[model samples]
Target: MTTFTSLPPEITREILQYLPVPTLLAFGLTSKNNHSIQQHSLSSLRLGVFHSRLGGMISLMEATADRSCLHSVQMILPKSECRKKDKVIRNQNLRIANVVEKYTHTLRDLEIACWELQESAAMSLAQLKNLKRLSIRLDHPHTRFSGLDPSFWETAPGSPVWNLFTSKKGEKGKSALGRLQSLNLERAGITDYQLTKILESNPNVRELSLRKCVNLTDKIFKILAEGKVGRKLEVLHFTRCCEVEIDERVLDHIGRLLNLKELSLYGCYRLDSDLVKKLNDEQWHIEDLTLPSTPSSPNQEVQIDPEYK
Candidate 1:
């Protein structure tokens, strides 16, 4: 019988990648060979870093030192109230800064959720050179249901925090996020101007999801239709949002996205049959579509186009 130590290094590393983090840590203690395999397996991982401490999801930034080789990192925060006394929340700003400084050059996908704007985290985020997928959720856990102020969306271009991820004037080769393909913003206080800047910065994005963002307005959709931003978009989702009304014309404009395959609009009470007709008439390419379950008025019912299967 062959001993585990006698196995080839490739097989050892492959097996290690699937092991639970605690188990992997335990294996790392067995011998020098096991430690080397564990390090190799962890360096190339794609991790979903949730706020919860469950299952095998360990914080990549906390778990490894050389995390630059990571292909994906999803940072999630609980929608429910986070205890103010928790060390995770208190030291989060410092941890985020360290992670970004350590791995900015090779980082790909990044997802961040902050109860409030921490300058350190914002600055750290700007340093990522190869980020492809970015998901930002910026609402306080305690204030999820409270109405948001409109002025929160009006961000100035000169703001250091906003400028970090954007191209400086006349300093262009490619976008800071040339590799970006997907973006998700939830309750992030995004205004038309800020959204335009982000879209312009990452023009190649194919999938966009905006949820519970109260600051986005109809004019933003108009911009998306008229500008180059929506050209490559294949999937779009807007849910539980205010200020952005999904009227018939908006749907007509969205139909221009030739590559669109999935369109989901949930709790946008303003949507009606007119929007459905436009989607149906234009031969929209959406293969999956979702609409609000409850119409604004008791007499109205949402109509889904049969062609979109």
Candidate 2:
């Protein structure tokens, strides 16, 4: 009577690849045979910077080699809502780059949700050439969701992170993120100027979301509508950006987007849904428009067409 681990190494490796991280990790603890399989198939990793330690991170990074089918990598910080200490957060922020550099070859989707943008770590983004979906959410506990505080948009010197990939002419050569597709910067509190520079850099982007960014204004959307990248964008999400007061002019600009499929603008009281319906003179290929839900309204239940999905 032979056990599952008694199978050939190649056979065992193929079977173990389909298991989830926890199961694969558990198998590794059972026997040395399972450890090799776990090492090879360890493609994706999701861990909180504060919840885990550096030694564990180093071990995982070392394990990810040519045999490892690395697919996605996410390195997120503890949320500000949890009331974490500043010193702890700062230390974690500083160490993110060191941990990430270990697996630059395997990285694809990268997300960094923190109270403040880790400028140092973000500067090294160019190294991750295969990164496609980038989500950078910077939200503080005290920062109002309705509008951005002045301090959050302090980019007079310009953000090194924003400059990392956007510039065609790097000090050395072309940086990473040339092939990026989707970018979401919800609640980063970036101003129009910084947004403009970022858009200018990533011209091939298809999906764009700036949800809950307090400092952003209509200017950013206008730029998006008219720019080269703006034309190619298929999905646009500007939800809860109360400060982004858009009128018919702005709507008209957005209406020109030829490939826009989904438009989400929940909590944007300033924008008129009626105008959004009527402003389609150019006949944009829009499929769905998501708005805010209100119990006060007579039409309490708004159902999106199931076919749209």
Candidate 3:
């Protein structure tokens, strides 16, 4: 029975991988050896926190600064506070921004859930040259504040956060991301213009997930399916994105993406039987296809026979 303290640093680090973020952080504080082990594991760490003790977590995250081991950080806001307005929330965001600014060079994957995204926060994240994956969960103003003025959605283009990734005035086009690969805007109210701008900048993306993004329309999908941007995309997950209706033409355009291997249309009720049949009959190289739970109607049955490519 080897105690954690008795194990070598390499062995200790391997064990740390299986532990939760908080457990690893706690173990790191036990001794200098444990701390070093934890630091090494930080590069592969993926944090998913619905609610955590902010002070302690921040301190731990900061302590691993020199290690520069973080690859992904997923911050899930408390469901109760998702729609509430509070200064503390802003402070917490500032703290996150501070951490990101200090270590953007090492961070690769970032996910944030917030009531609204400020320009400054986007700007801070844009500085991360190694970022490959991003996910943003935004609470719609309409859903959060029923009967709120519609004008609240209208913000000036030059706003600090808005301009963060956008080209600065009087400058040639420059992308904030250099190595981005996958982007997920689940439930985020991103406009077509913004999405195009991002795709144009990160053309090397391979996987794009727009799950539950009600704001996106068919036009956006048209652009994506055409492979005008994200030509290298191989996996597309458009689950529950009811706003974007997929017609046969759109499906045909998607089939043209020769490199696409995985297509997920879970909960997309707009996709009819014809489109499904076309996808099943097409001799494309798609290896995985995900659909929603079926209806009881016999006519709605879609039989996907397994055939190895």
lDDT, each prediction: 0.60, 0.61, 0.59
Candidate 3, residues 75-118: lDDT per residue as tens digits? Answer: 64554543434443464466557656754654566665544566
* Best by the TM-score measure: 2
Candidate 2 runs further than 4 Å off = 1-47, 50-84, 140-160, 167-173, 280-282, 292-309
At residue 250, give the lDDT of candidate 2: 67
Regarding TM-score, does 1 or 2 come out ahead?
2
lDDT of 2 at 22: 63
Q: By how many angstroms RMSD does model 2 differ from the true structure? A: 9.7
Ten contiguous residues minimizing lDDT sum, candidate 3: 59-68
TM-scores for every predicted model: 0.63, 0.64, 0.63
lDDT tens per residue, model 2, 11-69 = 77667665765677788887786565666544344433442334224423432122333
Regions of candidate 3 where Cα sits further than 4 Å from its true position = 1-89, 139-163, 166-172, 228-230, 292-309
Which digits, one per residue and each the tens of the lDDT, describe model 1 over residues 1-309? 998889998888777766765687689889997776766664333433234543114333323223343344444545443344243443455555665665566456566544333556666666565777776654333222223344433321123344445653346643455557877776665666767877887788888898766667677677878777687788888776744365555766776777778887776767774556456556874788776545457778879999998
- Residue-level lDDT for 179 in candidate 2: 65
Better of 2 and 3 by TM-score: 2
